[model samples]
Structure formats: C-alpha cells, structure tokens
Target: MPEKKLNQKRKEFNKEKMVGIWSLVSLEVTDENGQKTYPMGEDATGFIMYHPEGYMSAQIMQSGRPQYASGEVLCGTQEEMAAASNGYLAYAGPYQVDEINKMVTHHMAVSLYPNWLGDTQPRYLDIKGDTLEITSQPVFFNGKEHNTKLIWKRVS
Candidate 1:
C-alpha cells in the first residue's frame, strides 16, 4: 500500500477510538415549519456514554412543551417534560460505528418508548470531539410525526 493510503487509514481508525464514554450537559430542539420556529429549551437534556464493551446508554429529558402521542403539548411545564421523557431514560443495548458512511447504529433498545422497546435499527449519530449528537427522526405514531434530537458531552 502507498504511504499516503496507509496514513489515511490510520487517521480513520483514530477517529473511531474517540467514540468512548460521554455525559449529557445541555441540549436545544427547534421545531420549524417554513418560517415559524420554536426552541424547546433545556428540558430535553441528559448524558450519553458509550463503552468499548459494545454498548451505549442515554437519558434525555424533554425541556419544553412539545407534543406527545397523547395529542397534548407540554407547553412550558417541567412536569410535562418529565412525563414526556419517562421512557427516554436509561436506554441501552449495543452499537456499531461505520466510519466510511459516517454513521453509528444502535440496536436492541431497552427504552421506555413502546416503538423502541425491543431491537431497533441505527437511529442517529454525528460525533465530533467531546460531543456526540444523536437523533431519532420523525416517526409516525398515532397518525402524527415528531422529530427529536439528543446531545451529549464527553466526560471520560
């Protein structure tokens, strides 16, 4: 192999090593419809840490009032945010990193969400430095679609 090619491969390998444990510090979500937008503040925040043991876990809190499957938007209530995120805490199972595709896939989600209560496909992963931003895109539940984002910071 050429020296340049070997160096490139080494760099790619190094980036994967950076995918270790991380903690959640803060997060913000924006719901946009063309020109109108809303910021779901700090309620949707938590820590997510990945282990070399082939598993990762996350806990997220809904910060602002966002619509739930029950056809209700919390709208400026912490209790509502907490209730909305009841199943979002302590989700774990296994994960895989795809460097060439710039993707990370999570499987077997032991989460509170009924839709993800069992094995699942890769939902989201965009890692850079000490931050790993993962999202579960809009999914249709009860004939409605909702988009969400979860952010975490490296602690270990």
Candidate 2:
C-alpha cells in the first residue's frame, strides 16, 4: 500500500480499537500515604464495554459474593442487600473520547451508587494493543480519599 494509505489505515484502526468489551485484569487504589489496596479483593472481576454509538457500561464485583437465605431477588434483608451493594460497582452512560489527549470522560447517567448519577469523570488512558489502563482523580470512598488505577484486557 502507498505510504499515505497506510497512515490513514492506521488512524482508522486506532479509532476502532477502543470500541469493544474488556475484562478487568486488576484494580488498585492508592491512598495519600502511598499505601495501595484492592477494595474488591485480590480476585475481583468485572467487564467494561464501549459501544459504537458513543455509550459505555462497566461493572465490577468482588469475587464470591454471598447468597441471601431468602433466595428471592427482592427478599434479601437489609444486611444481605448492603453486603451485595457494597461489593459491587456499576455505571452506564454515554462517553466521550479525546484520543489526542489519551483520555476519556464517562458521563454517568445510571449508576449503582446514587451519588454518582449525573457525574462526569475524566480518566487518563493508556491503551496498548489488547491492554488498557485507566487512572482517575482522587475520589472519596468509604471516607478516605484515594486514586484508582484499573487495568483491563480486551475480551472482544
């Protein structure tokens, strides 16, 4: 192929690269004291997807969540429901990509945590072939402030 054609092809390829389903590899939280922790446990799991229509969805959960004794979806006691919610994180909304800056902003239209609704968060991104890493600004979680770094591998 001609040099110009090759360059154009590469650009197109890059644009489509971010649109796919990705599996979580790891999630790390760093505190002000430089201590690192995994809020979802060492074996946490999740998936994040970017659709062609400018929408995205992400879900993360701690491994081995407990089942409520009631067995019914809506019959869980307050404690059971709290445990389930505390172990999971999920949100979906339209997203904007700034490829030149290696950043993406997620506009949260729906979220498992009510406080996150209508929030727009910008995340720095580093994408290499099938792997993607995203880092966020400091966020207050369960009281203390921390920053998050998440690594994901393309699954589709």
Candidate 3:
C-alpha cells in the first residue's frame, strides 16, 4: 500500500486506456464569437493511433477532394496544390499523457504545416464511453482565435 506503488499502478491503468486506434467522428472549432465551424468539412475522415510505446500519428482529410489531373504527386498545378493542402492535415510524433492533469501533449516531429513542426501541442482530454474528446488550447485560425474539439471513437 505504498504511495509510489499506487501512483505507478494508476499510471499504468491510464496508459492502457489510451492505447488504440481511434476514428475521427468530428472536428469542430468555436471562434471567439462562439460560432462553430467545421474546418475540414462536415464529412471529414481521419484516424489517430496511440501506441503503448508513447508514439502517435494523426491524419485528417476533408472528404471529396478532387483527383489531380496529372495523377502525379509533384505534377499538381498551383491551384490544385493549394486546394489539397488547405483541406488536409497530418502530423506525427511522440506523445505523452499526463494522467493526473488529464492532458496529452503531442511532440510534433513532423507536420504538414511547417509552423507546427517541433511544437508541443497539448490537448485536454475527456473520454466518455467509446468517444475521446480532445480540446486544444486557443489557437489562431483564419485570423481569429478558436478552440478546436476533435471527437474520436475507438476503433480498436
């Protein structure tokens, strides 16, 4: 019944709850004026995976993206590249969960957006049933501060 042993046990239990593949249900953002918007369209599809070894990756893309005319990754026109980049997001890196604080920080080693690379993004976590809701700290998007809420359902 030692305190250190109890704390370690709790950490293990919490870590176990976080390891799995989660499918994106919704990604919503509420601006400073309290208007909600779906930045990735209403039917965006994505998945986030958490590994027991403390790594995670997330990729979310807006649905119905048009195919490139050239069908080549580097041959897309400027307009096509812009449209594709604007509607897609991907990042991967090591992640750490603070069970006591109810937060998870994703140490971004790489990201689609250059500014996000090498950033430690912390998200408040709230897990309910099969859903995991992660709320980001107020972030500036399109010139306004917004808090993004990503709801994920356990897939594995």
Candidate 4:
C-alpha cells in the first residue's frame, strides 16, 4: 500500500499463473465489525476466466433463480427482468496484473450493471495450487463499507 512498494517490479510472480478458467467456491462479504455474509447466498455458482491474451470475464449468480412464466428468454416482463438482473452479475474486459502488489485490475469495458461500465477495479489476487482468491478493495454499498473475498478453483 506504500508508494515505494508500488513502483517495485515483481520477481517471482508471473502473470501467466492467472490464465485459466476457475469455478466459484465461495464469495464472502465482511463488514467493519468482521461480520460476514453471502451476497448471493452461500451456495452461489459462477465462473471467472483469465484469458492468455490479457483479458478476463466473470459471471456470477444466485442458484435456483426463478424462471419466467413464459418459459422464454426474451419474453420476461419488466418485473421478471429486474429479478434476473438483481440476482446476476457479469463483466468482461482486458485486464492488467500488477504482480508487485499481487493485484489484477479489471477494466470493465462492459458489464450487466451499467454503473460498472468503464469502471476499473483492482482486486488483490492470491493463487495457491489450483485455488485463486480475489479480494476486492473496500466497497461502499447497501449503506455500509464491506470487503469481499471470492474463492475459486481451477477447472482447466
């Protein structure tokens, strides 16, 4: 977090380690008092992929989302569509890794949430064996600041 540390080049950390598809394990949000909660339920499912071409994509959602009564993809009414969006998140864009900081920055060129479009977010990355842990910077939402930690496992 220091200024000098940010300028140092990474020695052993390689950006290549991040290139792979990962299955979501868990996403935990912790508040200031250390109380943790799951934003998409405890058994949420999703995938995050880091492409070799310096790009990344992540899609996450609560499992067992209600299906529209029409059984059609595009026929969902406003209420149905809003419910779907409320339970899902997705984004993709070129990414950059700052190995010194053990961080990866997701430049949101596109996202399901409009506010995230063109937003750049830095996530701390810790990869061990086949597991990758990405911790977000403190985020203020839902009336409180929280830290989110997402765990993932390599699938390919």
What clash count goes with each model? 7, 0, 0, 0
lDDT of 2: 0.91
Give stretches of model 4 more than 4 Å off.
1-11
- Worst 10-residue lDDT window for candidate 4 reads 5-14
lDDT of 4 by residue, 26-139 (tens): 999999888999989899999999999999999999999999999998999899999999999899999999888789999999899999999999999998889999999998
User: Per-residue lDDT for 1-156 in model 2, tens only?
Assistant: 798877775574454678999999999999888889999998999999999889999999999999999999899999999999999999999998876566889999999999999999999888888998999978887778999999999999
Task: Please provide, for model 3 over 1-156, each residue's C-alpha lDDT reduced to its tens digit, 9 standing for 90 to 100.
Answer: 799977985764476787899999999999999999998998999999999999999999999999789999789999999999999999999999888667899999999999999999999888877888899999886899999999999999
Global lDDT scores for all candidate models:
0.60, 0.91, 0.91, 0.92
TM-score between candidate 3 and the true structure = 0.88
In candidate 2, how many Å is residue 52 off?
Answer: 1.2
**lDDT leaderboard ranking:** 4, 3, 2, 1
- Among all windows of 10 consecutive residues in model 2, the one with the lowest summed lDDT is 7-16
Clashing pairs in 1: 24-46, 24-47, 43-62, 43-63, 44-61, 44-63, 65-75
Candidate 4's TM-score reads: 0.91
Lowest lDDT block of 10, candidate 3: 9-18
- By TM-score, the better pick of 1 and 2 is 2
Check candidate 4 and list the clashing pairs.
none
Best by TM-score: 4
Best by lDDT: 4
